[model samples]
Target: MLAAATALFALVASASAQALPSSAASPEQLALVDAQYNASGFPDSGAILTVSYASFVVQNGNAYTAEQVATAPTIYVTPSTTTRDEFNSSSVYTVMLADASSLGDPDTEGNYRRVLQRSTHYLVNGQTGTSTGSNYTFEPSGGT
Candidate 1:
């Protein structure tokens, strides 16, 4: 057990703190992700992700401020304004909402995990996506 723990520690110590995306993103996108990840404290995620999917943070009719989203009950992703026709209608997608500051906003387990200005982050899973013509509608795997 001691040897196994040592091996694990070595593996983690050698890994890059910067997230290396597994998905195919353009150079620009990859750069942006790296910058954001670095800026956000290079989270110690349970499982390192290879690709960060594009997700919209819309509250009103369009993009919203964190303050706006902090109070909103529902937030969903709409089709990308520039590329609406490139989506595959039959593809099922796994959408992850990570980096949501869960520190100092509201009470999450009495810890108050509502990030006001990029505090600690959290990874929200179980939300799956289904293509709806030119857009995708995401819902919890079991139901809405």
Candidate 2:
């Protein structure tokens, strides 16, 4: 009886550990993230911005591409004004977004886990009252 009880407790503990992150954020937070993603519309300035994604690589007995990697909630960050021409000509600045998690994980092969959460981030260059347009577009690789 003692052994059976101990085993049951261990199983329950394991299950709880896995379930913790699922409920980390409240429904309100999730809604806010969704709104931000949808509200990131561009202006009519005809400016374009290219984006690149980079992050740590976790090796769990195998390699994975960026797409294969699990990224956390993503956030889009844009410039305050149209920077497409500036970004292209100067190559100094670019737009960015992130998907982050409070409880980051690691793979079983002693590697940090990739973003697994669905939270996403996005940015707009100006506020509703601001007239400074910063509409942008991305110049994907290989003209694709």
Candidate 3:
């Protein structure tokens, strides 16, 4: 029950940070994330520019529930290179967040199909990069 918006805050927090140029995502990165989108009942936008993950940590609560995230929670943004040699630590990046209601349901014929509504939570531009490295902690307050 992970909150989809958690990634939005993480991007908002990471907008000022730098691109973490890790060993480019594996060859299966795009497929993996694409499959995720399909499974989540959302259409693929084909904009998997880079690899990113937002870790939301809430004290004494679960992210899946509304009561647990009454307010913004702590977010950690980690972005890495998507390809082998196309990432520039100084270039700008964009982040988008969308909400998916369910993991898809079966169709009338008993075949699984995506059948959930998708609403965009946020789309951020002017996302700059920070230092270059594999490990960098970016928080809304600032770098740590």
Candidate 4:
């Protein structure tokens, strides 16, 4: 009985850990990103948008050729406008550039993970206003 209880506890703990939420972009966030990208005049004619717990991406967009998706620089967005505290917190969304070459053995899923890792752009809500840079720019719609 003692051993069974211990095993059950361990299983529960592992399951709980696996079930913990990751800060990935939401549908609303994705739409905001798309709008901002369009507003910036950065064409994404062939890009594909995908979402996962790890990241959100505009894969194979006009930003990069199909073959170059592995090494292209990408924009990343936080699920919501980040506060100074949230930006400093560990639970902040993962937005960075991830290369397809660095993905995994199978490469497909790994490529997605890598893309999530390499997101360099962030999406700010209307409340936060707009921001711009040499490599990245975000202008929220509706004059916000």
Best by the TM-score measure? 3
lDDT of 1 by residue, 1-144 (tens): 000000011001111213332332344543443443453334322221222113322211122345433431222223223322333333333332223332223455444233323332222333343442332322223222
Off by over 4 Å in 4: 1-27, 30-66, 82-84, 88-144
Local distance difference test scores for all models: 0.28, 0.24, 0.37, 0.27
What CA RMSD would candidate 1 show?
A: 14.9
Please, what is the TM-score per model?
0.26, 0.19, 0.38, 0.20
lDDT of 2 by residue, 1-144 (tens): 000000011001111111112222234433433343343331222221112224432211233344533342111222223332333322422222333222123345332223223222332232121112233322212110
Query: Which residue pairs in candidate 1 collide?
Result: 21-50, 22-50, 22-51, 102-113, 103-113, 105-114
Sort order, lDDT high to low: 3, 1, 4, 2
lDDT of 3 at 45: 26
Candidate 1 structure, TM-score to reference: 0.26
How does model 1 fare in lDDT? 0.28
Determine the C-alpha RMSD for candidate 2 after optimal superposition of all C-alphas. 18.5
lDDT of 4 by residue, 1-144 (tens): 010100011001101112222343344544544554453334322211221223223332224333433342222222233221222222322222223331113545543444335442222222221333221222122211
- Answer with 2 or 4, whichever has the higher lDDT: 4
